[model samples]
Target: MKFLSSLFAIAACGLLAASVFAAEQAPQLSGCAAKRQDITTQIENAKAAGNAGQQAGLEKALSEMNANCTDADLLKQQEQKVLDAKREVSRRQADLNKAMSKGDPEKIDKRKDKLAESRKELQDEQEKLEKVQPDEDDD
Candidate 1:
């Protein structure tokens, strides 16, 4: 019994360590980072053109970079939410596959619909994030 307890404790510690390591290496907003780089290029172009108004827009974009761009906390939260949603969708898909294998046509169709909805939600969030402009100026 003591040996079994020690083995269980070691396994638990290993699991905990793995979880912590995974959390530390969480997914980041590379997409947002790429967008920021593009914005920087646009700002440089505006500066070259010597357009005061465009420069102002570039400044605003820089301000947003200082505001939302560097803030990884919110991005991490959003990414985690998306990951959870993906896991749920994957679970449903597995169920769908099982149903199909068992020849349950009606259940398979229902599961496919649920999977489609989950995918749609994920796509919408991605699109919205992609559309987030750094500058509010629209002239």
Candidate 2:
């Protein structure tokens, strides 16, 4: 019984170490490579689920990414998204201010919600932009 328990414990430890090693060995993809991987994963899922329309769309998107998706272009697009998000946040802030000035509690609450959404979008865009590191050529 003691021998069996010892073997089981050793086996558990080995499995845990193997799992950790596998996770560590997986490369952390970023930029266009990461984007490609994501789209590919989606395509595979769509295919597996028998969603022909979605699979076709994902395939088209993957092809487009393959053809025209460059690191520089991706960086520029992410920057533009961040800029647009910022503009949207500013607009929402103005709307909220207007609503507050009118002293309408309902409108103020609605505008506040809109402003929060825009702010969150801006934050998400900023995070995405950070993930896309610019090449030296971009500088």
Candidate number achieving the greatest lDDT relative to the actual structure: 2
lDDT tens string, model 1, 61-85?
8778757754355456556667777
State residue 136's C-alpha deviation in candidate 1, in Å.
Answer: 17
lDDT at position 112, candidate 1: 93
The clash tally of candidate 2 reads: 0
Off by over 4 Å in 1: 1-70, 129-139
Cα lDDT, all candidates: 0.73, 0.91
Clashing pairs in 2: none
Query: What lDDT would candidate 1 get against the real structure?
Result: 0.73
Tens digits of lDDT, candidate 2, 99-138: 9999999999999999999999999999888878754555
Error of 1 at 71 (Å): 2.8
Q: What TM-score fits each model?
A: 0.42, 0.76
